[model samples]
Target chain A: MRRAFTEELQFISDQLVEMTRLTSTALDRATTALLTADLELAEAVISADDTIDLVRRDLDSRAVDVLARQQPVATDLRQLVMAMRMSSDLERMGDLARHVAKLTRLRYPHKVLRGPLEPMFTRMAEVAEDLVAEAGRIIANNDVEAVPQLLVTDDEMDELHREVFRTLLADDWGHGVEAAIDATLLSRYYERFGDHAVSIAQRVVYLVTGEWPEEDLHIEERMDVSRVEPLG
Target chain B: MRRAFTEELQFISDQLVEMTRLTSTALDRATTALLTADLELAEAVISADDTIDLVRRDLDSRAVDVLARQQPVATDLRQLVMAMRMSSDLERMGDLARHVAKLTRLRYPHKVLRGPLEPMFTRMAEVAEDLVAEAGRIIANNDVEAVPQLLVTDDEMDELHREVFRTLLADDWGHGVEAAIDATLLSRYYERFGDHAVSIAQRVVYLVTGEWPEEDLHIEERMDVSRVEPLG
Candidate 1:
């Protein structure tokens, strides 16, 4: 019975890693769709999100089953609880990616990202991808050491997000209000994707170290320096 | 012992309802701060969020303790798990309110909601507040009958969210990119606030009926028709 419980716990952990992999692919595909105006790719990302949601529901239901049957205590119980939270975060990451894809579809055939901003957004996507992938590694191996590096990746994402605002606020910004709104929402979606990754990493840290690092849960709150100062 | 478990479950339910009240107040004050440029109110909303966080931690810890001691199964087990999920939704509701408050502080002394958009935002805030308060009532009374009305309120929120984009994309929009970005973020924030409320209400419906709603988990994804079309 005990060995069976151990295997169940491991299965739950593997499902979390799988979720990260799915969300990472969704984000990458969504970014490509945005930059290339590929409506088909965007639609694929949107439809693929249902799979992530199914995984989350399955994971949570399984966790609840483990709790009901095995009745784990202390560390084991906390791990199960934390697993459910990580799934929630990963599922949200998928939804954010779908939001990006939907935006692409909404502006079909017309490239939402243009010229110089394209590279910056590409970098943002890469960093966000790196963060979720690192989070997956941390979960699979319980590698506490990888968390600090994952956080550093999130900082890069925050910087890129701020750069987006600076561009929109610049006097030379010729993109007009519609493009600016698109950029604003797109930047927020990517930044939020990173935030969910950090949240997952933090949960792993807490599960292993039994201590929540003194940092905020969502780093976007502290780094929300992207606020718009009212123009004169 | 069974009586003790029942009491513990009730305590967790009351805590969820309390969190809804706190978040409702936070959203209300944040909107006032944005519309009136009240730095003090914004700062108050920001600081008070810590209390909501603390309540969630205490509630979850207690729920975990109950699960360990009672080893509840079946219906009792499901209620405990659902309580934890509801607390999470309420906690995120607080964070969204804080985001609104922080934006107010970031643009301090500079009103974020101006002129024509002011009334619409005020109405958004009211609808959000009503949704949360109704969620609290549903939790307290197991009020499945109230769920339909709560969803109708969310539809009103979606309408307001769409109106925001319409205003920003209007040809007569004199507000520059900065203001448009501000409006876009603010509208998304309030819309999300309503989404969380709907999430909590859905949880209640599922807990009572043991059936997931046929509608999407987050109405925002379905109602996200506020997409920006590119200009010529």
Candidate 2:
């Protein structure tokens, strides 16, 4: 019975890892589509989100059922709950990626407006990539040590986002009305993606330490965004 | 036992309503502070976030515990899960409000540049104010019917956000540098606040429908954001 229960717990972990992988891929594809204006890629991301959403619901229902059936005790219980909550976060990430893809497929040509936003998007993609990988790694190994660093990645994502806003607001490069809105919304999606990553990391800490961190410290992003100004 | 459980749930519901009410006030306070450059008000909002965060965390943990202990079946289970998720949304709402407070507190002394953004922010505040109240009302009564209309409010928020970007990209309304970055970030924060509100409504749908909406209109919001650029 214990072995069967452990396998069930492992299955939940596997599902979380799958969602994290898909979310990261979606982010990557969305950025690629946005940078290259690949409508096909954008459409693909949009359609793919349906699958991710379906998996999320299926996994959540599965987690709840496991709770009902197994009555997960101690660490097992925490892991199951973590899976449930993280599914929402992962699903949101998929949604953010789809938004990026929509930007790629948007009727307005983003290439018309030249700005540093592409670089910012690239950096955001890298950070998101690392975050999803770390999330999967943590779940795979149940690593507590990595959770602290995920917070740092989230901070970095915020800084890049702030830079994107500063660039758009720059007198030399206003990113136009179309570009400005795209940049604004795009930056927000990435920032939120980071927040969910932070949420995943926080859950890891709780699971491992069995003590919720006293300080969220996740919100203490470095640098005052107000200090940021036009790069040019 | 059932009566006692109902009473406990009632107290929890009261706390949720009270939290939503105070946080909406906090949102207004933060926005007002941002618009008026009221450092005192901004500071108050920032400090108040602590209390809101505490309540949010306590409620979330308690909800999970209650669900685990009581093993609420059917409607009871759904309600408990919904509370857990909504409290998380409320916590994020608090964060967004505090973010606006940071903007207000940080951007002090730099007078807001009069541009198209001011109107956008005004509209956004109006929409956000109404939606925030609506979320509380829906939660208080568990009214699923009200969610569809609230979903439209999220769409309007997107429209205003797009308008702000269009203005930023506008060639005529260039406001130089200092006030522009502040304005851009300010609008972005408002947009994000709206996103959190939409997330809350989505959870309400999930609570009622027992699944994520077939059409995730909110996720694609930023995807279509670049489409509203003013024609030359």
Candidate 3:
């Protein structure tokens, strides 16, 4: 029974890594669709999101089953809870990727990436993909050391997100309101994709260290700095 | 021991209801701060978010304890798991409200909403507050019947969110790109607030029915229709 429980736990971990890989692939294909106006690829990413969701639901039920049957306490219990949280973060990352695909489909034959913003979206997508790939590695290997690197990647995504906004809000921005809205929403989707990756990494950190990432940073400081200004 | 476990479950439920109430208050004050540009109220909402976080952490630990000690299975296990999910949704709702407050503070002394968008924001806030309040009642009373009403409120919020976008994209839109970006982010915050409330209510629905809301509606149809276009 103990060995079976151990195998169940291993299965859950493997499932999370698989989910992360799917999310990364979805983001990659979605970005490709966004850049190249590939309707087929966009549709593929949109449809593939259901697979990620199904994986999350399966992992969740498995985790719950382990909790019920194993009656795990302490570290074991934490791992089960963290698995649920990681699955949620990864699932949300998948949803964000789907959002990107939907945007690609919405614009269709017309590319959503207009002038000046194209490179930023490209960089955002690259960062998002790297972040999810790293997230998968962390989950698969239980590598706490790789967690900080994910934060740095997220920072890069954040910088790119800001650059997208700067171009949109620039005095010379000629993309008009529709394009601006598209850019705004698309940048946000990519940014949030990075954010969910970071969140999953944080969960791994907590799982390993039993300390929340928020404890290392002031709560106020942890709030999306890009979204708010320093209080007077 | 069974009695103790039952009380622990009740306590966790109470904590969730309390968290819901706090989130509703946060949204209310955040909306007030946004509408009035009341820096003090904005700061109050910002600072109050920490209390909600602390409550969530406490509730999480307690739920973990219940799971570990009681080793609850079947329906009881489901209820505890659902409580944790609800607490998380409430905490996120608080964070969304804080996002609203942060935007208010970011644009302090100058209002974020201007022109025709003003009344729309006001209505969105009211809808958000009402949805969260209903979520709290659902948690406290275990009122699954009220879940559908929350969805109606969410629909109202979705309409307001679309209206905000329409005004932003209108040819007559006098608001500059900066204001448009702010409006975009702000509307999203409120929409997400509604989403989280609906999520909590769905958890309640699941707890009562042992059936996910998705099973009631087509999963693809349930995916945020406002964000995506129908696949051709």
Candidate 4:
């Protein structure tokens, strides 16, 4: 029974890594479709998102099954629950990729991105893909050391996101209101995709170290302070 | 043991209701702060989000404890897992409200939603508050019957979200690019808040009926179709 439980835990980990791979590929394809205005590729990405969702559901059920059957305590329980959370974040990342693809479909041959913004979107896509691929490696290998590099990639994505905004808000901005909106939404999708990847990496760090991530330290401090405050 | 387990389940339910209430209040205050540029209210909302996060952590730990101790199966297991999911959705809803409040802080005395956009945001806030309040009621009473009404409210929010975009993209739009970006992000906060509420309600319906929500029907259909497709 113990060996079976161990195998089940390993299976859940493998499922998460697979989900991450699919999500990474989806984002890459979605980005390509967006930049090149390839409707077929966009459709393929859109259609592929369902697979991510299905896998997430399967992973969640398996996690719950392990919980019910093994009744894992302490570290084991945390690992199982964290797997569910990571799957959720990965599924959301897939949804963000689909949103980018849908934008490509919506604009079709018109090309939603143009001018100086084109290169920014391209870079954003690259950073996002790199981040997810790293996220996959971290999950598969339990590599806590790789986590900081993921944060750096996420920072790059943020910089690109802000750059996109600056270009839209610049005085020399020539993109019409429609294009501006498209660019704004597209930038947001890539930015949020990076965020989910970082979040998954953070969960992995927590799983390995059994400590809260530093970014959450402030919130934990505030939570402590709030608890001591006199009741209103 | 059975009685204690039942009591623990009730405690988890109560925590969810409390989380929903806090989330609803946060959105209300955040919306008010956004419209009035109330720095104090915005600060309050931001600080309050930490409390939500702490409560979520506590709820999650408690849920895991129940699973490990009781080894609940079938309906009991579903309820525990669903509670965790709902708490997560509510916690995310709080974060979205915090994002709205942060926007208020970023702009300081300057209002984010000005002119015609003001009323639209006001309406969006109302719908979000209503949906969350209904979510609280559903959790507190186990009132799955109220689920459909929550969807209707979510639809209302979607309409408002679309309207905000339409105004931003309209030929007559006078809002500069910065304001447009602000409006786009703000509308998304409210829209996502509504989406979380709908998701919580769907969980409630599923908990009661043992059937998936209608909205998921299409995704399941797509998953079926994807399974038969030739591998690329």
Clashes of each: 0, 3, 0, 0
Cα lDDT of model 3 by residue, B1-232, tens digit: 8899889988898888888789989989999888999999999998999899889989999999889888999989999888888887888888888888888888879988889988899898889889888988998888999987888887788778777877887789987877887887788888888888888888888898898986433233333523522222
Model 2 chain B: weakest 10-residue lDDT segment is B223-232
- Model 3: clashing residue pairs? none
lDDT values for all models: 0.87, 0.73, 0.82, 0.82
Return the clash pairs for model 4, or none: none
TM-score against truth, every candidate = 0.96, 0.87, 0.95, 0.93
| Local accuracy of candidate 2 as per-residue lDDT tens digits, A82-104 | 78888988988898888777666
Q: Give the per-residue lDDT digits (tens) of candidate 4, residues B1-232.
A: 8899899999999999999899989999999999999999999998899899999999998998898888888889899989999999999899889888888887887888866999999999999999999999998888988887887787677777778877876778887777887887788778878878878888888898988887853432221211211211
lDDT per residue (tens digit) for residues B1-232 in model 1: 9999989999999999999999999999999998998999999998899899999999999999998889999889989988999998888888888888888887777887654799999999999999999999999999999999999998888888888888889988897877788888888888888888888888888889898887755444643533323232
Looking at every candidate separately, what fraction of the true A–B Cα contacts under 8 Å does it contain? 0.54, 0.22, 0.38, 0.38
Predicted model with the maximum lDDT? 1
Quality class of the docking in candidate 4, CAPRI style: acceptable
Report the C-alpha displacement of residue A19, candidate 1, in angstroms: 0.8
RMSD of each: 2.1, 3.3, 2.4, 6.2
Candidate 3 residue runs with Cα over 4 Å from true position: A214-232, B215-232
Q: Which candidate is the best by TM-score?
A: 1
DockQ-derived CAPRI band for the predicted complex in model 3: acceptable
Error of 3 at B134 (Å): 1.1
Q: Candidate 3 on A8-80: residue-level lDDT in tens?
A: 9999999999998999899999998999999999999888888898899999999988888889988999999
